[model samples]
Target chain A: MSLSPLGASRSLAAVFLPIKSGGLVDEVCRRIELAVETGLLTSGQRLPNEIELAGALGVSAVTTREALSQLRGQGLIRTVRGRSGGSFIADDALPSPERARARLLDLTRLQISDLGLHWRAIAATCAGVAARRSDAADIASLRGYIRPAAGDGQGATALAWRLSASEFMLEVAAVARSARLAREILRLQADMGTLTLLPFGDPAFCEHIAELSEAVTAAIESHDSGAAEARTRELIQTTTNWLLAEHAAGQAHTPGTTEEEAS
Target chain B: MNGNDAAPATAELRTLVEGIEGRIDDWAAATTRWLNDAGKLSGSAIDKFVRPTVSDMLLAPGSNVTGAGFIASAGLLGPDRSYIAWWQGEDLERVDALANFSPQSMSRYVGAEWFKVPVATRRPHVTGPYIDLLCTDEYVLTFTHPVFRGDAVAGIVGLDVTAQTLERRALPLLRRIGPRAALVSAGGRTIVCAAPDVDAGDVIGPAEGAAATPIGRSFTLLAAAAVA
Candidate 1:
């Protein structure tokens, strides 16, 4: 069930229940998360007035106000007042990696192989552009992005390294000076970010990021656009294949299906 | 010059003049009533009556009066001047005369450079009692109604009435009834003046009394009552 942009949900009140069953502020935060996850809300979209939202949710305006304040504190939303003002989603609020993973799983329901194919196509284009266009300043920015992983151990180091690699790719896209290409890269990164949240627990994912980063850096340094593009595609495919194998093995152990049905 | 010799001839001429005047008055009165009742004066309707009745009278030999009618928008008459619907009479004379007294014309009287204020900052308005710089022989009064379509104000409906004409026709009755009147736009610019000596700017403020209702864009009746 993909969420519509119009904020329609099957059970609006039920969506808010988890937060209500917790603390008042906590409830608002929970509901906001649900709203974003279920596509009942979007970045930079305005919410109704506090009084209106409270009335609809069967809560006091004060409670609604407190919840809004808490959401603002968490940098999730912002409020504007006056004749044409209302609460709006903050432009910068991307959820934590774990939450993003959950959202991606809910939306895509994709096998690892499919995810890999999509990433390879996206990363190859991004890398080719980066190799062709990147200058000294771009390399410096990319190096800054990876610096946090330098002294860290394997798992923690890998997460930082992968996040930096994503940021580097995004920066490269921005340098490409084509808004359309940049936007496409950003969308791919967002989807990929969601998929990697829980899967970061795997050490092989970390090793893959390190290897891909080295390949990308070498290609970028050599100004070899083809090699950069190839390496990025290879990295994405490798990760994707591992995830597909894991999914297939999990399905094979399930009770109801035969091997043919599982496949 | 002999009274007895010319008495019958003079009497016959006087009778003819009186009859013509009576018919002109009747025609003007009927048109006024129709315009007031309809709350709008369409060009087609004006074309049907104005030339045959009002224009013919004004154009009559020895009358020394040449009058025209025009449908004005955005402070200028519509472009089709040759069309009876667009003819404003006597070419540029009447047009220039009226334009000099229009709200855009009077914006110079006050230091304001514009007639209609933008809607974002507009307040309900009424303005009058300014002398028209053009058409020095007669005073003029204008009633402007702002027309709004949806959330935005589109334009104004302006009723331009010559003060000399109104004084000759309706002033006696208006004075007797002691009716205080003004013309205002949606943004409240006073387009013309009835009392030339008085300040039109002062007369125009927020539309008070009955003018607040949102009527059609081009026509609105502020308040109407029997003058008796």
Candidate 2:
């Protein structure tokens, strides 16, 4: 059996079971999609081999296999033909900027603001909890992700930096010990993944991210939940401000839109 | 630490929890009686039989009830056909029975913890200290109970209470329970607090063996003697 991370199987189970009235298959797909999106199921990490996943999720092996096939078909996961291979999240599953922009365009300004509100709540709460609960090992892992990396202006390099930054935030969420909040942060991070692409390639943005990461880490290490939340909120606001500006620009371009509605 | 010092705090918090639970049970019983007397509680019947009377009964002195009504089903209330009887405030004697639960207003209530959780579980739930700009436009506590007609859930009946009233009700008990005390929601939002330094909506960690108990059918209130 492939070894899953500590409490990972349990947390995944929490997501699946207590299934509300809905399509089971679609629900299963969403949970797995969200898990992968949040980096809770990291890139290249093999899922709890098919049978194990089926057992843990309380679904039939056929159902599990079908879900895995769906993920593979969607390019979110892949299967290798070998003795040791299993279903794994694909390394290059990040959404393209165009895809993200299209998604953003689909939302109303109010919806975007609502999403931002939820994201801020979960992220700030996670920051506070992480500051209170993080141990030395957690601190070390957090620090490891913050070290500066040269992007070289390549698309792949920028993607890697984005993923690393997400990993750092996910680590904080995971360390906070609230699986529920972690799940939320993960989903929000995935949704914001595309939005974050806008600020990429800016050296000033990169420098700001590094400074923020360092500051957040110091606050958490010093057990300052208030500082940790404030810094995280600032980081999230950076994206929120950008999204609001983009939304306003979109409104300006679309004629016949009412001033009241736009506001 | 000596066992004696810890005993009183636990006992005190437990007593407060019991009082709240008793209140919830009383409300549940009163609702049951109302349903029974109405002969049949249906989506349309809620407006005809229940809304007007409950609004009046709830307005009794010190009764804190701001809004009382029923949600017929998941998609029952469109922007225009909203079925709620809401009093504007404690002194607002008039209740608006035909008020529309507007589309813009629905933004704040539809996916809220109070609405979503109870409907899904078919159980009673309490969610709040949240500002409802759509309805009351105040920090309010929403108490919801799923209306079961036979085996299936037909709709839901909900009541809104101002956070100020809940705080007034809970704080004295918390003060007595301290060293430090708080009434935390199931989602870990601190609703009413007697802890000097903590505020509502503060994220509270789990308290071990504190006088923690589930209120209504879905919320867990933790009144810890020690810092949690």
Best by TM-score: 2
True-contact fraction for model 1? 0.00
Encode model 1's per-residue lDDT on A1-263: one tens digit a residue.
Answer: 77773566646656776643437657656767555532336678776667756644446788888888888887889887788888887886644554544444344336455656766776678678667655565577566554344555344643455456565666555434334555666566555554554455567666666667677767876779999888877766766765565555555565565655658
Per-residue CA lDDT of candidate 2, range A1-263, in tens? Answer: 76677678888888878755436666568767755443345567666677756544556788878877888888998998789977777897654566666676667888888888888888888889889866575688788777434443234344556666776777777557554576676668766756666554455665577678888888999889999999998877776777787777866776766676659
Evaluate model 1: give its lDDT: 0.47
Give the per-residue lDDT digits (tens) of candidate 1, residues B1-228.
Answer: 233533343333334324433443454345445444554444345546544554454455543233333222332223321112212233312232222213333332222111253222332222222223223212334333333433334333222344344334333332232243323334343222233432222224422443332222321222222111
User: Which residues of candidate 1, in runs, are more than 4 Å off?
Assistant: A1-112, A147-162, A257-263, B1-228
Which ten-residue region of model 2 chain B has the weakest summed lDDT?
B96-105
RMSD of each: 29.4, 20.3
